[model samples]
Target: MAAREYGQYCGVTQALELVGERWALLIVRDLLVGPRRYGELAEGLPRIPSNILAARLKELQAAGILRRAPRSRVVVYELTPYGRELEPVVLALGAWGFKAMGDPRDEQVVTPDSMTMALRTAFRPAVAAELPATSYAARLGAAELLVRVDGARLDVSRGDGPVDLSFAAGPGIRRLISGELAPDRAISTGVVEVLHGRGDLLARFATTFHLAA
Candidate 1:
């Protein structure tokens, strides 16, 4: 089926016409972090039906928002450069929604991509400059993320690598990162386990990312 349109020529309406469908923006959100194979996308968006997922991918591809290319004989979906221009928009939306978020319901799921994006959105360069260069290995269940902080730059990528600090991602970890809970409290409660590196490094990690007051 063709995408439903508001039949208006305004830019905002036109943009929404392209991306306002159910699960459309969330698909873009997942792809923003990195290229994902079909199964990986499905895993990230477990609530979306397979048929709907397939259809949305096709629609986005046709609209020039995303494209599929083969990597090592396996096809992966990724946003085109044009599509990536939506990063600021997505991040802004995330920041705006942060204050409105009350709590996670039982059915709500958190994926690695969402966590990565949250880190990206929460990063504070001014605060990061106060700390020395460091790298973090974040393990959330079976997912691993490598976060590197150099000067005022912060980079997050998938997979494990040699790092200065390592910790498990959980509710307490999320709270620490978001400033909802203090680092000391999280550690004392055993919510965040530091597998490697000094406790100071974990303290610095907490300072780097935070939600706006």
Candidate 2:
């Protein structure tokens, strides 16, 4: 568990003590997506040292923030009900951190879980409420996602299906989501490549999932 104890008794202090270690909240972040087998988590977090991942998992399990359970005869790790409450906190943190995300480094690679959460963080329910339903199949680096927005609800999943727009982009898609780049410009500049479906919906997709600066 806890790396160290803060002498002061406070809610924030307690919260940090519970999940302050590096990669702890990230474990929670992935589990928030859904249950993941140990190998799945390892694959998603490529940089995490095997021992560190195991240690964090044990710490989180000890804190009751997550648990291991059987799924299709394989054990998977999932957040506990108590841990699910961190969704909003994680989203808020992601938004705050996004302001400092100038660009991705050469070593940084986007994972499906991270991309899913990023889309969730940028999703604009109010704006989407006024737009028609749309679906987008986006491939960012090695991540592929099926994003559907109906009214104010957004559903994101791995893999592909029938979609209004299917495109591929690297990390530059952040510019699109953050409203820094217009859809036409993104397409024209190769920031996004339309593989299938209507390219016009990219504008709608931009409107639906946006984060101001």
Candidate 3:
């Protein structure tokens, strides 16, 4: 009951047999952003045909990559606790691809790029080393954003109280941690803007974390 493939030595190959089909990984990636309804997932993943997307969601549900939950009597696909466990795996894959391309000086992760996934991957023990007991705020256009620290989680979209800082980098929240855009330059160009927080605190916080490219 090991689920081992008789002739497969590569673990990835065997795993792929279960989830390596077309657009399957993308489904998993979208789920990592947050819980989304079937229609929402389809909207986010426009390249996927509706019929294929539906099929893949069903397959993922069966394989435990996603779980179906009742949302207003309609089934919605959500990442299970087990499925959330794959965030690191997908992030690592994205970072590997970025580095493998051999262009460190450029912003490898761009808009419509999976920067959120990269940030999710990069926000680990090493990067958050000495994480001070402080919160961060990002002032996105027309939306006040706050990321409060809850142990290992960077709780997003709290949108509560006075924002400590602001990041106005379009929709690509993932680029900040993906190492494609410099935190400083991005600020200068208005892609990111810090409205509050002590400079010293911000500097220290910046040093303690990094976006995995």
TM-score, each model? 0.89, 0.96, 0.69
Model 2: worst 10 consecutive residues (lDDT sum): 1-10
Model 1 Cα lDDT, one tens digit per residue, 1-213: 344877677999988988889999989998999899999999999999999999999989999999999999999999999899989898888888876776577777778898788788888889888788889998765557899998899898987788998888565565776677787777777888888887667778889888863
List candidate 2 segments past 4 Å from native: 1-3
Q: What lDDT is reached at residue 58 by model 3?
A: 84
Model 1 CA lDDT for position 178: 69
- Per-residue C-alpha lDDT of model 2 across residues 154-203, encoded as one tens digit per residue: 89999757888898999899899889999999999999999998888899
Q: Give the TM-score of candidate 2.
A: 0.96
26, model 3: CA deviation in Å?
Answer: 1.7
lDDT of each: 0.85, 0.91, 0.62
Rank order (by lDDT, best first): 2, 1, 3
Task: Name the better of 1 and 2 by lDDT.
Answer: 2
